[model samples]
Target: MPERALRNNSTPAELAVWHRISRFRPAFTRQLVEAPFIIDLACRQAKLAVEFDGSQHLDSVERDARRTAYLQSKGWTVIRLWNSDVLANPDGATLHVLEKAAECLGGTHPQPLPSREGRER
Candidate 1:
């Protein structure tokens, strides 16, 4: 599906988590296209990909595993959270994403992209 459509049709669990973490400094993109695949959510600066897996994923364990391995080989850290877990504890799900971002970025706060106003103009 197109990224925009994916965002518009996002599951309740995804919307919940997005609202919680979308304001992070380095920012995140939902349904981010990464060539052959479209990651559920990705923070490029942190090289982190977050996926909210629903029941359909249960039947695709091997496929998912290979995808994760491929992403890892490409230097991306993939984190998957169960849809029910996200719906049950959105805060925790957001925290896990933040924690993984921090870890991947090697810091608690990623250095923000400077705006024109913050640079010599």
Candidate 2:
């Protein structure tokens, strides 16, 4: 799909976060897998899926519960961030997300700093 179109369809909140994250590397977003389920945002290698929770969930608690159960059954770890969280603590939230993903992938929490000046290798 075209870049302009993607931005146009995304929520302003989602777009803002995406813009910041895209500065380094793009994080995956809405995707459909073999079945009909469309994930909010996921990383297959990281085995992580991120979602935004809103008032709608309160109205459909059972449905959300089932969906969470299904994903967990499939071995996918799901993380939920609230709309207010994205608005209030975008930076901290981003770092927390990166930390969780790294943890799941069995890597260091804070990606190690770049190799220093050569000491004559």
Top model number, TM-score: 1
Residues 41-120, model 2: lDDT tens digits: 66676667776676667797788777777887888788887767787887876776677777877775435566878857
Tens-digit lDDT string for candidate 1 (13-40): 8999999998885789899887678889
Candidate 1 deviant stretches above 4 angstroms: 110-121
Worst 10 residues of 2 by lDDT: 23-32
- List runs of model 2 lying over 4 Å from the truth: 1-8, 23-27, 30-34, 117-121
Most accurate candidate by lDDT:
1
Relative to the true structure, candidate 1 reaches a TM of 0.86
